[model samples]
Target: MHSRSLLSPLARAALLLALLLATAPAMAWGRLGHRLVAQLAWDGMTPAARAAALDLLQDEPDPSLAGVANWADELRANDPGLGRRSASWHYVNLAEDGCHYDVARDCPRGNCVVAAIEAQAAILADPARPREDRVKALKFVVHFVGDVHQPLHAGFAHDKGGNTVQVNLDGRGSNLHALWDSGLLEQAGRDEAQWLEHLRGLPLRQGAGLGPSDWAEASCRIVRSPGFYPGRAKIDEEYGLQWSATASRQLRLGGEHLARVLNGALGG
Candidate 1:
């Protein structure tokens, strides 16, 4: 019933292509989301974890948790070679096999986000690592923890983590990936103070009951939910509202999980 029905095959295909994007889903949480997680982690860090982390952060421009929130993405420009080398570490593609994650098949070579979290935690935990190296490791561990909790970051591989699913989120022309990355958070209209308050209000965890694959599976389930697609580009404000809780929950989870990771590795 759409205009595409009247166009030639090539024209229809091209028209559809024009509306899609194939980029890696923008880093989860964009800048704001990551900062929220960092602040939460910092607020709850043990004295030992705080000391070890800040020691590595000696010369950072902004010597606070939120300060380095976007460091991993910034490295894409600040240190292009290393950034390229670690590009795949930000997300793991979950597709074809349904909600279950098969580590060997889905995360071969230890390149996926779950592995990135483990690897960076190791570097942060190892006292012998150079201070600068530990700093970089700390940044990625913080960033990837945020990444794994972004629903689309762990979404279907077929759609490039929903990057290919074109949509309009609350009057903004954007895709599903962009919507989750920050659009919904932005739409919430909360300031950093409010977000931090919300984060603190969430129940503290013992880091039990969930891990990277569980986190990934949780996101995959959200992306594949019947209510999520909403005719793609036709998804509007009401649809976006339905999932605001999900965004909040994921952001809170990111903050909580990151706190545990940092404390476990550096808390001493």
Candidate 2:
């Protein structure tokens, strides 16, 4: 008969190490829900827009495309079922909450991403700047444009925009911020391309009906929704039934608006 004590200490250590290795990628990239936006930026835009997007993306000190790509590749290699959309939730939350200069307080009214976008506009508007520099400026604008659309990126003063609100997602213990970051998007079971296609099909209006301030306000409106966490005690059940759909719709709308603004900004 096999005994529990039959395994050596080295064998146990090896098993533990292997398990950790298996789970590490999920822990890293699974939580980084913003990969979809980056992927879309890289794939969906025009060549000039893509270049501009890359320039804008450089504002984030970490979480670069290469870093996310490596993390994603590792996760996919380990688990073929892991989809790129899995990262959108984390990305939205990170953009909203993590972009803040102060974790203890609300994000500054004009944050880094906002500032970067405005700066890019200035560069793009400059007549004397070279085409190369203008392209670089446009890249930053494209990236930051996507960033601001993430509702969580425009977070609230309280709970660090849901980061401090702990809850369980589908019985998996997580935080409110985390739920918004990846939980709902993962539940959708669709890839980024599919999601983007859906977003593109949404009813979109034209001619400056929305702008940067409007984007910020829209996110804040969602973040401040009265029913956001109805019945605080039953957060998990409530989120499953109500908040998840809200988050999904918000993400879809955000992506659609992001594409619209980029197309307009680039004079497309």
**Best candidate according to lDDT:** 1
lDDT agreement with native, every candidate: 0.76, 0.47
The TM-scores, one per candidate, come to 0.86, 0.55
* Candidate 1 lDDT score relative to the true structure: 0.76
Question: Global lDDT for candidate 2?
Answer: 0.47
Q: Can you write out model 1's per-residue Cα lDDT over 54-111, one digit (the tens) per residue? A: 8888789998778998999887889999999899888887755787888898889998
Stretches of candidate 2 above 4 Å error?
1-112, 124-139, 169-172, 205-207, 264-267
Q: What root-mean-square deviation over C-alphas does model 2 reach?
A: 12.6
Any idea how many clashes model 2 has? 15
178: Cα error in model 2, Å: 1.6
Sliding window of 10 residues with minimal summed lDDT for model 1: 1-10
lDDT of 2 by residue, 1-268 (tens): 0112233544543332333223332221133334554444444446665454455446544534423333333433655564342223222222244333332232243334445555566776564788766655554454455556556556654565565665532233445555555554544445566655644454533344766655666666676666765445334332433554455455445445555545545533
